[model samples]
Target: MLPEEGVNAVRVVVGMLVRGEYEELETLTEARRLTAAEIAAAVRRHGRDLISPPDEAFRELGGVAVPREQADERAFHVDFPLWTAQDGLSDLTLGLTVAEVMDGVWTVELDGVHAP
Candidate 1:
């Protein structure tokens, strides 16, 4: 099993599958003041799982993903296989941060998906 923090973070991403479908959180928030490019680079460096193939990442959980979009600078799409047992593979958009792209610090929030 993953550590408590990892499970919590993943849960947040899974929860996003509910209703907000088009809103993506900005990697650069006014408070943090980091640029998108910087954030992306940071994420790329530290959060390989953030950009890794969905199936590859999900394999740790005994599941697989049907990728609709290859991970890119902004977002990626995967039918998450284990989010809901009844739903099976549910379509989910993994929102990208500039840090995730450029390789930034590995935080659960920074490495997580937002609404997309």
Candidate 2:
């Protein structure tokens, strides 16, 4: 099993993507900011409105994502495979890696999202 905190952070990030809440991603990132170019690139690569579940769906979508691999909580890198959308749960997985700013606190890094 993955750490709860890490899993939840991924959930929030994925929810923002699904809802097309691009601006909110900056807050969840390690640098605490994302330039327009970066966000634009992500949109171009991931596509806008890839998933559009209602706000409440965040709570119900994807059970905790188990990391295919992870470091100890105190380690800086925590990478895992996570489903990007509800419909793709059975097959699709996006590679996600976070940097632990502090113990047990994982923040998404730039280039953190990708195909596994």
Candidate 3:
């Protein structure tokens, strides 16, 4: 479950997503907007190589549903806070991703994260 603030934020983002408006996502600790591609690159560069490798520590927090097309009957959305456990540094930045909601949850195949 999300806190009051996170729940409110999700509401706003979900509204925007339904309208086909994709933009930066906000969390309790970080403030920035990141594209799906940008987030993927960052994760590959930092998290997979130097910082935290792909492991159980990296997990999905939650997801938001977005529209793929006005005509298409497919579903879409992005996941945030792909929490990756860190060593000494803060793990806030390690948790970020654009994921596709599948089977009532986010799919790892379509997810991407970033590191700071």
Better of 1 and 3 by lDDT: 3
RMSD of 1: 13.3
Query: How high a TM-score does candidate 1 get?
Result: 0.28
Query: Which residue runs of candidate 3 sit more than 4 Å off their true CA positions?
Result: 1-44, 47-61, 70-76, 83-85, 88-111
Clashes of each: 19, 0, 1
Which of 2 and 3 is ahead in TM-score? 2
Q: lDDT per model, in order? A: 0.33, 0.49, 0.36
| Clash-forming residue pairs, model 2 | none
Best by TM-score: 2
Tens-digit per-residue lDDT, 23-73, candidate 1: 232322331433445444433443222222244444443212223232632
- RMSD to the true structure for each prediction, in A, is 13.3, 6.4, 12.7
The reply for model 2, stretches above 4 Å from the true place, is 30-36, 46-48, 52-94, 112-116
Q: Please, what's the RMSD in Å of model 3?
A: 12.7
- Please give each candidate's TM-score: 0.28, 0.51, 0.28
| 1 versus 2: better TM-score goes to | 2
